[model samples]
Target: MSRKLLNISIPVISVLLGLLAGAVIMLVSGYDPIQGYSAMLSGIFGDEYYLGETVRQITPYILAGLAVAFAFRTGLFNIGVEGQLIVGWIAAVWVGTEFDFPKVIHLPLAVLAGAAAGAFWAFIPGLLKAKYRVHEVIVTIMLNYTALHVTNYLIVNVLSDKQDKTENIAETASLRSVLFENLTDLSRMHWGIIIALICAIFMWFILEKTTTGFELKAVGFNQHASEYAGMSVKRNIILSMVISGAFAGLAGAMEGLGTFGYAAIKGGFTGVGFDGIAVALLGGNAAIGVVLAAALFGGLKNGALNMPLEAGVPNEIVDIVIALIIFFVASSYFIRWIISRLSKKGAK
Candidate 1:
């Protein structure tokens, strides 16, 4: 359908425009645009090491993207993923330290603790929205602060070590590396990628093939109508938020249990939760789309480090390019016009 073509065209055009804009900026800054782009390309796909890092970076983005996309499907703006992630990270770390279980049990238990904590954090906003008619946007946004401060306080006072970080988690609590250390030769790629991919597929199935997913979508489209039709609007809203938070929590668990091998206190809020908004938008709120979008973002982010060295361009150009791409994609009127013109030409 033309409509589908337009949807695809818009993003493709936006990306081209972003690259062109980046070139312009590079010229203005007295840098070689060609070299800059070449560097970025090489950094991502040139070697197995960089490729592995790209995958590593994509792992969290996938979960974060899913968190935001899931909320979008439910017509809720869950801006509290940062809060949920922080709580998840803290809970995971705490459990890792306090318990002494075998490897199989301990790892899963700590990850589950993180998910439970994140779900609890999300439940607050969900409850308020369902019971008191509170706006989810406001509640979730404010909860980000609550999570940040509470986690910070706990880390500083209770979890802090002599060096200001909690002790490293035992091997039992960590996910065994699949390819990071020796196998990958210093690359950070790990089994988390597989888990993230599985989660994405699971979400796609739930959203596209399940009865509960339809109910949630129905509530999202028209809560009042759903209520009249005997569907419990309140319950669906709460569940959606809780599930959204759980995905974010898994992102945190990936960081703590898979990447960091322990939780380190964040001196301030990490922006991964907020960045998830951009990821969701770029992904078009689809599970597969989110995975691809996350991979693109991860490449840009990871490759930025190598740009300065190889291209003599500032890494900040990647940020600018991303912003432009998002702006153009969001404002798709131009893309529609272009597609319309092309279609008319073909007809002629």
Candidate 2:
């Protein structure tokens, strides 16, 4: 119980520390930190449009967060989410552009293709790690490069438009924001958010309410013991990686089908998959916690884009703040010490 409380308190304390660090940096840079923070808060929450953009920014973060959290629960670190996302994005766009089905059939098919692509991409590392005892961290990292180059080649060669970018997907294949426009007057928010939310819920159910989840957790805790108890540790490891990849793939789909309408030319990933590590840490690998953490990250990311336009602050300031938060969370012993001292005093 105390440990759980500490986990919750750590992020709160990290936020406070990050804000303080940001303020100090602002002061050194000869700007008012208060004004900067105020502007950031306002841009993210001041109006309906801004709020919608916040959610839009959050869409991919949610899925990415889930990807990382899912892997963490299984004692795996899937850094290949970037690769998984790229393949998923490519598969989704391919399906969306090639299919001529009605909305009901087309949309689901495209999304499922994305998921399958991601899962398949992930399975490679899972198999290597489980069967040959290769470290997943190394394999996933290498796969990131593979996914990047492979995706770049496909988009620029086979799928490229006249201008070298892929052609826009058909309207029927796109996830429309018309419903959100009616409510918030900001069309940026789309059905991707709904899908992300559902995925989170589904994962929560699987992790918290299912026997497979228990076996996975057991393996995460002690693979040797789980294997001794007749659980298939190797299979569970592969399954966990595949599931993690699928979530990452969904994130890629959100960025493509939901936002860009098609896969566009890219120098590299936008780092959403990498950012998922921080989100999962901040959320303590909890499903509901992932949603909240993603929202915070999304607000920070979106608001940072406007800070330069409004306050002359570099958007990288947000990255620095995020780094500080993650640093403090990783070194949460300090916060725990302070909390323990405070509690001792209160008890007296």
Q: List the global CA lDDT of all models.
A: 0.85, 0.87
Candidate 1, residue 70: CA error in Å?
0.5
The list of candidate 1 runs beyond 4 A from truth reads: 176-178
How much does candidate 2 score in TM-score?
0.97
Instruction: Please give, for residues 1-348, the per-residue lDDT of candidate 2 as tens digits.
Output: 287787788898898899899889988988778778877887798788888889988988999899989999989989988889988998899888877998888888888888889999999999998999899999999999999888888888788753446777777777766878787675578899999999999889998999999998899999999999999999999999999999999888877788888887678777998999899889889998899899999999988877777787877888899999899988888888888999889889
Top candidate, metric TM-score: 2
Pairs with steric clashes in candidate 2: none
How well does each candidate superpose onto the true structure, as a TM-score? 0.95, 0.97
Q: What range of 10 consecutive residues in model 1 has the weakest lDDT sum?
A: 175-184
